[model samples]
Target: MTAATSVVAGETLPSSMRASVLTGALKISMDERAVPTPALHQVLVHVSKVGVCGSDIHYYREGRVGPFVVDAPLVLGHELSGRIVAVGEGVDTSRIGERVAVEPQKPCRLCSQCKAGRYNLCPFMEFYATPPIDGAFCEYVVIESDFAHAVPDAVSDEAAALIEPLSVGIAASRKARIVPGSRVLIAGAGPIGVIATQAARAFGAAEVIVSDPVAERRAMAMRFGATSTIDPMTEDSRPLKVDAFVDACGIPRAIVSGLESLRGAGVAVLVGTGFDEVSMPIPTIMNNELVVTSVFRYTDTWPLGAHLVASGQVDLDSLVTSRFDLDTVEDALNADKNPDNLKTIVEAK
Candidate 1:
């Protein structure tokens, strides 16, 4: 049977499935909705794991992020993994039952940026959990088959869910062009910071240092491969110590501090999101001839992320610090906001 038929036929498919829908700022509810059908080129996936992202929490509390505003009630999750249950008309049904991670961004393939293989910059991208596009906080999600990457049998559903953020780390590493033995500094020892540290190590960085105010996060950073963890508030010290720096915290202060931490001609990749306006030492960047790069999201990195986890190179198990059921997504998000939590996931049963 085709994937679509399989979804309809599966005993696991409930008439109505639980979903965490965002009604307004700080207003989320666990409601039931009819299982949706897959459109052409789409596949229906029975969601197994959903990661609670910083962006998800920002939207929940603020009702908007950057240019995207939640004008309507929307489902609020994107980082996810699941098993394909049904395929659309043009999709290959053979993919059914495959455990996969979904790449949430669906860019218009015909866009100029997409044609250049930098689809992450595509202006017409429909990303899940962003304003208009409903996310995978539900039991089932219908997504484009091409965006759903099959995970290796060795990877667990929980690890597969982490592929989303892992891809971001990979993308940031690629953007910075991290070379073997390069001295790397990652600002912010949060989830992305920890993953970026690991990704930089995977890319052969000689020394990886992470800086954050949270002592717990810095401690976790050491466990995740940070050569040193710095508390910027602790003391003022020599700042130009690293060959490359990654601003994974997104806070303006972190970005500014990352710029200060880089060596001459070093590259700094911005991987986090935050307030639009922030002051920086522009003259230092010009004088040092440093390159500053920003990553919107990921492109062509999910499969590699899954591979890294399956091969046991990324150590996803240590990164997933918390998990919640579909009904407690709000609590999960709120908990993640706490400094103690590393990364949180919502499991759909």
Candidate 2:
């Protein structure tokens, strides 16, 4: 079922909504908030599904991530999908019924980075769920019309929200240069890891090996696209001579292990968020002529993510292991403690 309410043309929207707010570390409260009206060139979306990400957990657990700290109350949720319920001036009113996957970050188009087509690096980017930037953990949210990407009917609400993570996987695949007949190794069989496996296969990788400590996650990786799964705990990762290695786990050791497994002239893409300080294998990297790169949030990836799900090249529904309503958002955030769950979805309406 869809995650939000359906509205018709010219229908008057409600005045208020129930908002899930983060007051501090491990503190969450449901409060009444006014429904936001879309501004010019914007559309009001009836929020449906919100995917709980690791960053959300970090904020919930520590009240901060890197330099961004929670000094005031905020909403937390970036991965989202919803249906357009209203439109602002200059927007086509007929788009009110379109189901869309919201691209949470909006960059300043006038910046040099945006002009050069590297909008993800725009210094003035307003990203949702980040400190001082409220996200969509409420029933209604407004976004620029261009950021509300339409999705085909075949994609479920939860799957649509997951496109955010899929976009991350796609970005990593592009950076790592996963091509036909290429052998790729992915570290960390978490949500991003599994999605990266599928993205690699779609990029025509001949073989994908997924490494993880959990037996369940490794099995999940195999189901997604991994030709083989290895338990990093008991197995040595240096034996695999793959052309590309993607670190989705973010652990420093995992990154080092992936580096050790790469072939000469191979590439390594860091996708996971780890410690600010990491020790690189400088000698091995220089000797092998290895290329190491990293990807931030995606750019020009929503349509690709939609197409991948629509065309059946990637399966998104299989990633879900738990679901919660907005009232139970805290439980969804803590779901990672349960090793069996891969993805947790929170319904905003």
Candidate 3:
């Protein structure tokens, strides 16, 4: 039977919904799809807002990001927030009608990584918008109840959707071991870099220096808690000393420069997705005792992300440069082409 023919009990909801499907590179078709029914321990969410991410754009422009390729039709959107409309068995009915921010990852809870609270490293993980797994560029989607984190009234729908990226920033900050009175140097002023600045400050970093090529983004970073800004295009030769370096820009030169800028025993946390491999100064790393690490996806960061947004410690609305609807998801994914644009949101509801 079709999904429309088999409806979940309780809610009088439509069986079919509109979805923006990525048929191939640079091609998106608006297709009607069945509104999915929540399975056991899952919740049916009426997707409201989805934030456009760089990975989504990669999948759109190249049909691939690293090894994950889009050979079949796909739906591309992961940073999303919505309202719970229905609940499956094992979920409390009271959860219905709650506003929530989705974590967008389903990891095998039985894995060793999951047992250690590092589910982001679960070997058999399914992430939204990553080729095979369909994402939230549709009217309704179902996610595990635990991954659907409820947001406070103070967090707007757009902010709730953006909590996903904020979690990324939080994860990077945690990995960098940022502490009160620490100094942090963040390369790149993109959405993640800007958010990382806020996360660092919230984590008690005394100073956050942001380096970027764009003047507008550098200025924007200042408003988002950056103590100072640098134009890497002109100031790439300058040296800096800091407790931690967060590379939000995938550029190789920036990574090398950031490594050079670190003080002895400093930590470097790489958050950006660059090429598969890049050369690094091994001798410098050893001599300085600089700890280097990278983040795949966030692990157990949704609650802190939401709390930061609700408490006004982080301002997400300021980063929203444009808005689009599900029908215009193509435009939303390409919004970043405009250098002035910081972040774009696609409304599915």
Across residues 1-349, which tens digit of lDDT does each residue of candidate 1 receive?
3335645346656667888899988888888899888888999899999998988998998888888999998998888999988888898777878888898878889989999998999999999999899999999998888999998888888888888888889998998889899888888888899999888998888899888888898899999899988888884424656888898888887788788878888898988887788897999899999999888898899878877777777888778878899888889879875677898989986
Winner of 1 and 3 under lDDT: 3
Compute the lDDT for candidate 3.
Answer: 0.91
- The segments of candidate 1 whose C-alpha lies over 4 angstroms from its true place after superposition are 1-3, 7-15
Considering every candidate listed, which one attains the maximal lDDT? 2
Q: What are the C-alpha RMSDs, in order, of all predicted structures?
A: 1.8, 3.1, 2.6
Tens-digit lDDT track of model 3 for 1-349: 1122222345578879999999988999999988888888998888999999999999999989999999999999999999988888888877888899999999999989999999999989999998699999999999999999999999999999999999999999999999999999999999999999999999999999999988999999998999998898888623678899999988999999999999999999999988788899999899999999998889889999999998999999888999999889999988988988999999998
lDDT of residue 168 for candidate 3: 92
Candidate 2 vs candidate 3, lDDT winner: 2
Q: Where in model 3 is the C-alpha error above 4 Å?
A: 1-11, 236-238
Spell out the clash pairs found in candidate 2: none
Per-residue lDDT over 268-296 for candidate 2, one digit per residue giving the tens place of the 0 to 100 score: 99989878888999999999999999989
TM per prediction: 0.95, 0.96, 0.96
> What's the lDDT for candidate 2?
0.92
Report the Cα lDDT for residue 174, model 2: 96
Model 2 residue 238 CA deviation (Å) reads 1.7
